[model samples]
Target: MQNDLMGLDSVLSQISDVRQSVTDMNAISIAPNPLSNGAVGQVSFTDIISNAIRNVDSQGQEASQKMTAVDTGQSDDLVGAMIASQKASLSFTAMVQVRNSVMMAYDDVMKMPV
Candidate 1:
């Protein structure tokens, strides 16, 4: 029973770690100097979205690795794996929600009063 609990703790810790890592990735951004506007490609919404998608993709891959580790029994912390899995699931859901909202917004814009 103690071992199981420890495993759970480890899984939870891993989940937290993954969440933190993903947050860190998303927090990164690049800003263009507004003072000098002589560029072929200036900062745009698409660039930000592309970076965000890449970060999310990497986080998903890391979560998959954690799950695989747990399934292989190579990781002695089942609890940590469980937590990580749950966190990953939640993040994925949130991303889906964001995508849905963006699409809806785009559609609304397309139907705006001209």
Candidate 2:
């Protein structure tokens, strides 16, 4: 089981690397995202943050539903439930880390001699 998980992790890492490469190769624009509400230029910070918050919320909600199913004997897939739980935990942790970084940056900027 451990070996399988390790193999899965490696595959995921490789996939992410490939995705990054593809993104880099395709990133040819000084203009805002044309796909984003037909905007003429780059996506705004607010849009990025709102999307991230929505993603976190969706992950938590999904994990909660899976947990409820397992608890009520509605689902027999223990592994799936565990995976969902872990994903939710990781997402929340990442969200917290980002929040902390943002707060620290804000503090540093405020402390700058103006």
Candidate 3:
């Protein structure tokens, strides 16, 4: 029972971390960009989405490399590999959710009379 509680605590901690990460991402993406001429510019939506995709891809690649290292006996860090895999999976899932939300919003906008 104690082990189960510990595991649940760990899961909750990870969820909290993920939520914080998402909040940070939103804050960074929406934060004003300062130009060389001292003008504040808005970050483009495309740039934000592109950066997110790149980050997700990089995490996935890192996870794959970790798994491969473990598989080929190049490394003995099974726990680390598993953690990376989970992080990559979570990142991908979050990106998918964001994409779905954007699509739904677009559909709703299209359906509305302009």
Candidate 4:
């Protein structure tokens, strides 16, 4: 029972790490610059979205590699691989939720009067 609890704790820790990454991605903001024409920060919306997609993709690839390694008897950390797979799944789900919200907002705006 103790080992099971420890495993659960480790999985929870991994989940929090994924959540932190998502939070950090959302925390991107435009910083004020004194030398520029009044344009926003260098980071654009497209760049942020693209970077987030790349990050999620990398995590998924890493999880797949871990699973393959475990299956081939190259790695003994099955629990770690499962945790990584769950983390990747959660991140992908979060990204999908964000995309859905964005689409809903866009639809709402399109329905508004000019």
Candidate 5:
């Protein structure tokens, strides 16, 4: 029985190692995205902001749909619904924070007695 348990542990360890290796490979497969010098000519900050806002809006909509599913008893996973709601809420809060920081910085710059 001791040998059996050791064999089982060995198998589990191998499985865990394989899983980590796969995850690492996936991370390496996705090349790093750097801001190119010509990126401004191709895509402005407004474009990036607009894209991000659109994505956040889409996520919010999906979260609402997930919530609706839960309310209608269509979703079996309440945790999944809750996670979606939290993600949407966090994304929205982040965007609001970003906006507030930018506004504050602009006000500070304007107030500079040059």
Candidate 6:
């Protein structure tokens, strides 16, 4: 009986929105800056990784806050809180899986004769 507005259309729209934003952000960075620094073409892997970690942490915190609000009688949107928490959990899981894959690739490369 909870409001699961995560219908197919809503989910598809969200995916499209995310894809558009990612493309837009990537385009901004890839564009040649008129007042370019020497590091114009350089994208720092560490920076990207750290930023992703921060984003995941923020999402987790937001989900926690939402759940807290729901539990403490501050907010009554239980479905929303559950959705947020699930989103945070899924993102974290995806990040972990990516990390594992990267580590496996690194290990395989290290074991190569080259």
- Please give the TM-score that candidate 5 achieves against the real structure: 0.62
TM-score: model 3 vs. ground truth: 0.66
| All candidates: TM-score | 0.56, 0.64, 0.66, 0.65, 0.62, 0.65
Question: CA lDDT of 110 in candidate 3?
Answer: 98
Residue pairs in clash, model 6: none
Candidate 3 runs further than 4 Å off: 1-41
Better of 5 and 6 by TM-score: 6
The lDDT per prediction is 0.79, 0.86, 0.91, 0.92, 0.84, 0.87
Q: Give the TM-score of candidate 4.
A: 0.65
Give the 10-residue window scoring lowest on summed lDDT in candidate 6.
25-34
- Top-lDDT structure, candidate number: 4
Candidate 6 regions with alpha-carbon error over 4 angstroms: 1-41
lDDT of 3 by residue, 40-110 (tens): 55677788899999999999999999999999999999999999999999999999999999999999999
Q: Count clashing pairs, candidate 5.
A: 0
**Residue-pair clashes per candidate:** 7, 2, 0, 0, 0, 0
Per-residue lDDT of candidate 2, residues 1-114 (tens digit): 999999999999999999988878633345555577655555567778899999989988998899899999999988888898899899989989999999999999999998
Report the lDDT tens digits of candidate 6 across residue range 1-114.
234655766888999999988877742245557777633564677888999999999999999999999999999999999999999999999999989999999999999996
* Model 2, position 109: C-alpha lDDT score: 98
In model 1, where do residues sit more than 4 Å from their true spots? 1-42
lDDT of 1 by residue, 9-76 (tens): 99999999999888776333445558658433445678777887777777777777887998898887
Model 5 stretches with alpha carbons more than 4 Å out: 1-41
Summarize candidate 5's per-residue lDDT along 22-106 as a digit string, tens digits. Answer: 8775222333347554332343568778988998999899999999999999988789989999999999999999889989999
Candidate 1 overall lDDT versus native: 0.79
